[model samples]
Target: MQQLESLIRAAENEVSRQMQVCNACRYCETFCAVFPAMTRRLEFGAADAHYLANLCHNCGACLHACQYAPPHEFAVNVPQAMARVRRETYEAFAWPQPLGALYRRNGVTLALATAGGLALFLLLAIAMKGSLFHEPLAGNFYAIFPHSMLVWMFGAAFGWAVLALAIGAVRFWRGQSPGAVGSAAAVEATKNALALTYLDGGHGDGCNEEDDRFTLARRRFHHLTFYGFMLCFASTCVATLYHYALGLQAPYALTSLPVILGTVGGIGLLIGPAGLLWLNLRRDPMHGDAAQRPMDRAFIVLLFATSLTGLALLAWRDTGAMAALLAVHLGTVMALFLTLPYGKFAHAVYRSAALLKWSIERRQPNRLRIGGD
Candidate 1:
């Protein structure tokens, strides 16, 4: 028991120390999205630390920015540190429920199921309205329902989901304690554990030039995919608002935006996954210890499948086939979202937060040092 307690104390101290080191590295400011938001504040505290920790979106810009610099080789892993903080925050505040329990466990399955159900319902409704089968692949599908209904219903739902998630995340951030461990001894333990983790490169070496190849590829693919999704999402939003709210029967060009956006988005989605998969394959996993887990591979494959199906639907325009592909695509998206809070995807939320925390924590002289001597 004494040995165990001592180890824990050592770990806490290490984490705290590394965090301080990261906070001192002002170079990270350029890459960190949250830096601008928190830099304006004169006073920094635990609350600020927690908030900043939650703000990091895990874009990996900081890792690239700090390469080849002093203390660059050191244990200042922004993404991992922020993820730890975000996990602590969520553990501290999320309401306990069966759904939450499921979310924590098999998030992918639950997400897939939810998306599948929604897609089925939507397809069924379209069929019942006799609007599922349409002429001229690019024709407007909203002619059956009042444009007002689509805008008020679909638009409001999407907007509300975004708002709610943002609010929930902020609330969670505000509720967490500064450190995972409460007492001084516990803090020390955490710091030591963090130190050991860094020394071993548990978060993996962020300094490798080879790794950058994959990282850059991922970034390019992601950028394409993101813009594609944004275009499609925005088109839907505009179409709904203009047709429903304003009672305007927009032309086929306006209504066909979803198809156009979907096609573009599909192309990006395919490019990203294909490139990433190639990169993942070409690398020597044994050399770098970069083996992806089955779940991770499954997720990637599902995403690729989703993209393929989306493109197929656009080409075929068969209601039944389109419905199936849409179901799969949405299921994959949901799985991605559900995995976000717990798995690797959590980095998106925590990385930004960590940046904020780093900005808030005052740097101490002689504390900066790279990992592994």
Candidate 2:
């Protein structure tokens, strides 16, 4: 344990040193969602550091933005450094084995099962009322279920899931402590790194001079998937509210919204995994230090299956085949959600927290200018 602590401290120190040398030029702002918040002032400080740390979404935008090349560049590797901080935090604050285990495989399995059950229930309700194809083209498919029941079910399920995730994250964050020695400086450095990554824009030094086709494509796919999910989620909320809560029979056309969103989202999700799989297949993993993990491949395969199944459901909504597709789609979605806390998806929550932390750290006087082009 002592050796582990020493290694972590060394890593933190090295990362902090690299960050302090950063000039705050705000070149990577476009990639960072928290840039606007960090640039509220010109000077960087502890608060700003914390905010920046929490604000960074860890999308790898800043890494691509930096002009610093390996072996000679002073360029800040914000993502790596932030990750180090997260690691440190985890070491200091994460709960004991059994509790932490609850956030892992067992927890994910239970959540997936619960989500699958709920989705099955919803799908059944739609089928029983003969609403699945009630107005296939017109989009008013939601008119079949009891509005109140739909609203209550969806609302409660989403609320509970979100709450549980939030609680787990809070506990994780609260576990880290810098200790008394150089605590202030270490925390401040952490904040600065976060701000730099979350708030800086313009691709670091200048335009991306390196070959980043794969990276850019991956990022775009992710963005599209996010937008698609947002649209689907919004449509669900609207349907529930309009049909169930307000007691209004919305048009069949309303159903098309989620379908369209789902289709687009499915496409993006598929593209992302396909691209990654292709890259992994072509690359010689043994030749480089950056070899892909087996789990990475597993994640890609799962996402691909999820997207394809979803698209299949959308394409064959009327046939008996649709039932099987629907089952696969629901299963995959459940798997994705349940894997959230432990898999790469954990980055979604950890990255957001890191960004917010960066935002708070960089909150300094006389540095209120938002960084951007």
lDDT of 2 at 39: 46
**256-292 in candidate 1: lDDT tens per residue?**
6655666677777677767656654554332221222
Q: In model 2, where do residues sit more than 4 Å from their true spots?
A: 1-14, 20-81, 84-160, 168-201, 204-215, 246-255, 272-303, 360-363, 366-373
What are the per-residue Cα lDDT tens digits for candidate 2 across 85-171? Answer: 443443333334233333223332354465467567756755775654333433222334444654565456455556555764676
What are the per-model C-alpha RMSD values against the true structure?
10.6, 9.0
Q: What C-alpha lDDT do the candidate models reach, one value each?
A: 0.46, 0.49
TM-score of each model, paired residue for residue: 0.53, 0.55
For model 1 the local lDDT of residue 251 reads 42
Total clashing residue pairs per candidate?
34, 64
